[model samples]
Target: MNAENDLIKLYSGRILSLAGDIPLTERLAEPQATVKKRSPLCGSTVTVDLVLEGGKIAAFGQDVKACALGQASAAILGAQVIGRTAEEITAARDQLKAMLTEDGPVPEAPFEGYEVLLPARGYKNRHASIMLALEATAEAMAQATG
Candidate 1:
C-alpha cells in the first residue's frame, strides 16, 4: 500500500496542504455550519465550514492550524462529503471510527481513500487530529439538517 507515498500524497496534493499559511480569518468563511475542534495534546485546531443546499453540501471549507494528519483529514472530509446527506455523513463518521479503531469494517474501494489514513491509527496522538475533521463534519451536517 506504499503507505509513505500515500501519506505524502495526502499531505501534498490534498487541499489541506493549501491551508498551511492561510490566515485564520480567511479560513473560517466557507461553511453554512461551522465548529472549532481542539486536540489538547498537540494543540491542533480545526474550524470546519459546510454550506448546504437542499440537504446536500453545496460548498465546504475550513480554517485549521494543526498537524499534517488533521489538515489532511479535513481536506478529505470537505471533499468527500460535499454531495452527501446528513445521515450519510453520520454513517461515514461511524465508519471512520470503526476503521481507525479496528473494531469494525473498513470502507470498500472508491470510498477507500480513507485507507491512506490507516497508518495513522497506530499513532495515538494522531488519532484525535484525524478524527477532528469528521467530528466537525458531523456537527456541520446536524446544523444543516436541523
Candidate 2:
C-alpha cells in the first residue's frame, strides 16, 4: 500500500477511540514518582505521575501531547496502569518495544490494546511518539520503586 493508505490504516477506529477518551488526563496529587518523555522525531511528549502501594501502582495520571498514535498509547496505559506492579509495567514496555522494533506479537492482556499500534511499526518516524507513554510510565515506576 501507499503512504496514504498506511496512514489511514494506522489511524484505525480503535486508535481513534482510544485517542478520543484519554484517561488520567489530570496530574496526580502528591505522586511518589513522576517522569516525562519526549520524542524528538515527532515532538510528542508524555508526562506521567504515580503513587505506588505494595509494589504496585495505586494511582496514576498523565499529560500527553502527541499524535493519534501517541494518544492511543497513553490511553491504553492510563486505562490499565492502576493496579500493575513495576515488573508488569516494565514487561509491557519491553513487549511494546519489541513489537515496534522486531515484529513481535502484541503485549498480553490489559496491555493487549497495544495491538492497535501494530500498524505503526512500519512507520519508523512514529515509533518514538508511540513509545513515549510507556517509556515515561516505566521511568515513573522505577522512580517510585527506587
Candidate 3:
C-alpha cells in the first residue's frame, strides 16, 4: 500500500477502535478539578473533570470534541485513569509527548493502548489533537492535587 493508504488505515483501524472504550462522555456532577485543552493545529478539544481521594483519582469524566485520534486518546486515558495517582498520570502524559515528538516507545502498561497511535509520529498535524486528552488529564489532576 502507498504511504497515504497506510496512514489512513492506521487512523481508521486500531486508533479509531480505541474510541469505543471511552466511558466518560458526560460531565461529572461534582468534580474536584476540571481542565480543558484545545489543539490549535486542528481545533480539537478535550475537557476533563476529576476527583481525587488519597492522592489517587476517584472519579473522572470528560467532554471530548475532537478527531478520532483525540477521542481514542481520551478513551485510553478514561479506561486507565481511575485509581491512578497524579504522578502516574503526569508520567503517562510526558511519555505520550515523547512518543509523539521524539519517536520514543509507547507508554508502559495501563497506558500502553497508546501504542496504536505510534504511526501518528510521522503525522505532525495530528500530534496536538492526540495529545489533548493526556494534557487535559494532567491539568485536571494537577488542579485536584494543587
lDDT tens digits, residue span 1-146, model 3:
69979678667766667776677787999999989899988899998988999999888899999988888988888889889997898889999999999988899879998988888888889889888988888888888878
Better of 1 and 2 by TM-score: 2
Best-to-worst TM-score order: 2, 3, 1
> For residues 1-146, could you state the per-residue lDDT of candidate 1 as single tens digits?
68777566555544355344332234435457787889889999877777788888777777777787776666556556657777777777788788888755655432456666776666676778778877877887788677
- Using TM-score, give the best candidate's number: 2
lDDT (0-100) at residue 38 of candidate 1? Answer: 91
Clashing pairs in 2: none
Alpha carbon deviation, residue 137, candidate 1 (Å): 1.1
Q: In candidate 2, what are the lDDT values of residues 91-133, reduced to their tens digit?
A: 9999999999999999988899899899999989998988899
TM-scores of all candidate predictions against the true structure: 0.74, 0.96, 0.94
Regions of candidate 2 where Cα sits further than 4 Å from its true position: none
Order the candidate numbers by lDDT, best to worst.
2, 3, 1
Candidate 1 TM-score over all chains jointly: 0.74
